[model samples]
Target: MTTENLLVELFVEELPPKALKKLGESFASQLFEGLKSRGLVGADETVTSYASPRRLAVHVCNVFATAPDQEIKKKLMPVSIALGADGKPTEAFKKSAAKAGCADLIEKWPNAEDGPDQLYVANDGKADAIFLRSMAKGTSLLVGLEGALEDAMAKLPIPKVMTYQLEDGWTTVNFVRPVHGLVALHGADVVPISVLGLEAGRMTQGHRFEARVDPVALTNADCYALQMADEGAVIANFAERRAEIVRQLQAATAPLGLKPVEDDALLDEVTALVERPNVLVGKFEEAFLEVPQECLILTMKANQKYFPLLDAAGKLTNQFLIVSNISPDDASAVIGGNERVVRPRLADAKFFFDQDRKKTLESRVSGLAKVVYHNKLGTQGERSNKVELIAVGIAAMLGNEKLESAVGTAAKLAKADLLTDMVGEFPELQGTMGRYYAQHDGLSDDIAFAIEDHYKPRFAGDELPRNDVGVCVALADKLETLVGLFGIGEKPTGDKDPFALRRHALGVIRMLIERDLPLNLDALLFVAAGIRGFSEDVAGQVETFVFERLSGMLREQGYSAQEVDAVVSLKPQRLGEIPKRLAAVRAFADLPEAPALAAANKRVGNILKKAEGEMGTDVAPDRLVEAAEKALFASVNEIAPQADAAFESGDYTASLQALAALKAPVDAFFDSVMVNTDDPALKANRLALLNQLHRTMNRVADLSRLAA
Candidate 1:
């Protein structure tokens, strides 16, 4: 089979910047996989994808002009149905062979062997079957590449598509942007395929302004990237363009003694916007820095697609970097134009800040009543009240009455920033604006900090609330969300969490576990359920959801699934104590006796589960009829109290370690004693003894979960 490097490019109008990278990746992966599945691509071949504002392309090396032929066997039917009296072909055989597109040669084919390898014999309730073998012709690159292009087009993650007409002005095609050109080259030969109403060609237009040639011509698939760069003034590869931008950013900032604000998403967007990037530095008036740097940065990055530079102290400077499409010889005109464009953006941010500070957070509290939190749940005002109550209850439980006032103040003002002009302009700065307003209102530092930090740890690995008041408020806020959403039967289902209840639950888990807070998760849910208009029945469901999140989060933090299952299966109320319990479980698993004890613990649990009723922990010595049972009872009596003491002292490792002494006796009891004896007294007593063992062994975690 002849082979060559293949290049496919779909040139369109400017695509959505955020979706460009994914679009490029999917185009390359899906097309390559489609070809490989058809045997047109070699095993050692590799693909490189290119994405820009106007194009999505892929280059594959070692692509075959024609796929290798495949040999396949077809099981027609049972021998009785497929063959005549002399083992000749029957009507059913002819029909089956025709359906497989090989009727002309079926009679010449050898008889199928009567063996287990034949697929149809077993299903047809026969020991023998008829089979036909044929060689399928290889598909030409033109036909295979067309199908691949169609499949790739169908799979692009285009949130929305546009319909346009080709040159004939009657036939319509749908794509992300209006389709302008298509390039499909197999070595130096055109594959002769069409997609999105455009015929494959060897020519593609380059940079809108900087191209030396209008339509760059490709001589072969291997030289596409180099030819485009030399003549078209465009960098086709997304990663290379991004790296070049990064290099320019670093070099540009080095002379100014500053660094660019680091944001991968912003960089990706800028890279997608320009095919030929020119990084330039622009500065605004220093007076605009009076506004919070967050507002300025948001306006610059979100609205203008600029990278705000920061000084060595990590403070936002008035200077910023712009990734422009054109690189002029003088460059001063570009810098002046960017500076002029950004001044109004910075000025608007400053205006919103100045106007928002005039209104106090307290005054804005009532305004939240008009904003609905959810249709089933009430307004933000009502939500804030519930959060306040939950925060107060948590503060009182923590025995910090002094923090109740601060917590209340913070929770009340937390959502007030949603009404601020600054926050209205930039919703990402909701908590931040509240803090600024709180400080402006002469509130204490703790209260101001709480107002800002209530939404801390908004995402995974985000920082927790900084102070006691903040902790109380953050917990209350997350609980209110979980309780409210879960109560209304809005629990997350298989990645469809419209309310972000999963994130809220993970936030609650992190605050409890990472902060070492003494809050009881069940108790917190119980208190939250008692709040007005909330259902108490959903408490278990909410608790399960939160613990489920914790289990997955712990596994992600490097804990094995078994360890997480062992610890989380107990549903320990104090999440803060989980790390210690897990530590103890790990330490116990390392001991020589852990396996036997764990298996015995599992056996004991199963035995108790089969009992007629509740088996009390009181093991009567008079009913200990077997020598093994007597020894086990004595061992439990000696070791359980020590384990209980260690458990009470929070020495989980020691508690689990103490139970190691009972492993041999436990093994003997299960081996020799009949837990379900003929005598009712003996059965009940044996169950009670096992119950005692189960309780002692599971102080830190359900050891049975550790059994292999």
Candidate 2:
């Protein structure tokens, strides 16, 4: 079969980055459906889409050369019968017959039982002019539809939009980004034919400067690889661009006795930055190293799109690798240009660092009062008070009396850097600035380190706080953020997380789990008692509410709702103990008969709930009579202490193992036993044993909520 390719290119001005990605994907999806809906499927059809700041292109290959070429029926009638009272088809029967093809095609419409039985008219020889006009009308309707589509996309909620090419004259297309050029093709033909007041065509301009108007011809469906290479440009596929940048980056920077800094996000950003990438090395004054290495590298990668070079010892080098759009003839000149741009960025950073050094850590602490924590909660000063409370409470809970005062002191100043000049200029340096200021102020090693460590695990898989004071302050800070925001009804909903409460909650979880602190979340809530955001009663309530939210926040770390519920049900005091409980439940979950075990746990729960529907805590153990009941009772009594010890030792699996030993005995007792005996004492004893079994099983996990 002979093949033909249809390429449509829509040239516009620069489009928003976000819109470029969205429009390309949306236009392709809609066009595919539009053609299919028109009953025009090309034999073995395919479409390839491409986009840049200035243009959008799509190509279709192996088109049918013509549509199915099926006959379409048409008919006309006298104005009185087929037309309206004015001029068009008048009678329903006549209009129906005309629409169907002819009067006979309607068959015995008003007379037949089958209803609307019509003649099978021969439409193959019908004149094309009739439906050809109809097709033109459809095309006009489609133009309107595409206009609406563009308006809808522009109105989509986004952070920012740039509209240099909006045809409506106002120009600012309200989108996360701007919409630039668009080209759409269907088998070498324009699909909707017109969009953005521009007709779609087969010609595409390449690489702005390289291909210029090279036609980007394709023998089949468009592949940008050859087109880009022939045009002295890089093909802009992210994956291909990433591979090329990395390979050449490694080769280019190797000669400098340094390796390219491994920053995945920066690498991904650079991959999107250029149409054709040319990796080269750039250098800066080694004296810039006097500034914090983090600030130096952040200045480079964050602003200049450069990757910092590091030696084998992992020390920052004076050199960096830069990915450039243009491959220059003089590599030295390009490097010189990059050095000039980056020099000022690093200089400002150094100035900020030096200015921050003048203030004592204690002086900076007072400035935190000006930082807004949340609108509902007052200022960072009020928030810091709660952190101090949390730190003291966790210290007491963990029996770290030695660090209690120190933890309190550190927590008070942890966020003080937020108001510092260094952090103001470089928002990423909030915690690091605290540590630097603390050191400059001649604070003790522990306090300065605590200031730095408090914001640990800012993201999932990031490092956690390493010191006692750091862990305490970290928990206080996170719990305050969570409870304060959630109390004011600022909880995250759908895709909106206005306060980053989820990340704060996850940070708390990671700090607790990784630090292994013996802190009770409930007790921490009590310390948050002094917190100014909500009532004492509501504060306690918010803590429990935020606990569930925290568990949800840990979802990305691989905890499921069932797993989270089971952990929460155990009433683990320290967030650190959650992982241990999660591991135990996960292990129990792996067993083939885990479903049965969960059933056993739930059965124990249901029996106690029914018996003690209104009973208070502390069931009396002496009211036994049934032999089966007494046997189960003694077995549970024997296992509770051992399980308790195992749990205290953090051997959750061992605790469950001890509790499961009663499973066989309990199962036997259930088979041979009659719990609801005539005597209320025996019934109460059975309920008490069930409670003991439930409580014992809960020592490791509340298996009732766990999934089989």
* Poorly placed runs, candidate 1 (over 4 Å): 80-94, 101-128
lDDT of each residue in 503-621, candidate 1, tens digit only: 88988898898988888999999899888566667878889888889999988988888788889999999999999999999999999998888888887788777778777999899
Model 2: worst 10 consecutive residues (lDDT sum):
128-137
Q: Estimate candidate 1's alpha-carbon lDDT, on a 0 to 1 scale.
A: 0.88
Clashes of each: 0, 16
Each prediction's whole-model lDDT (CA): 0.88, 0.66
Provide the TM-score for each candidate, comma-separated. Answer: 0.96, 0.78
For lDDT, the strongest prediction is 1
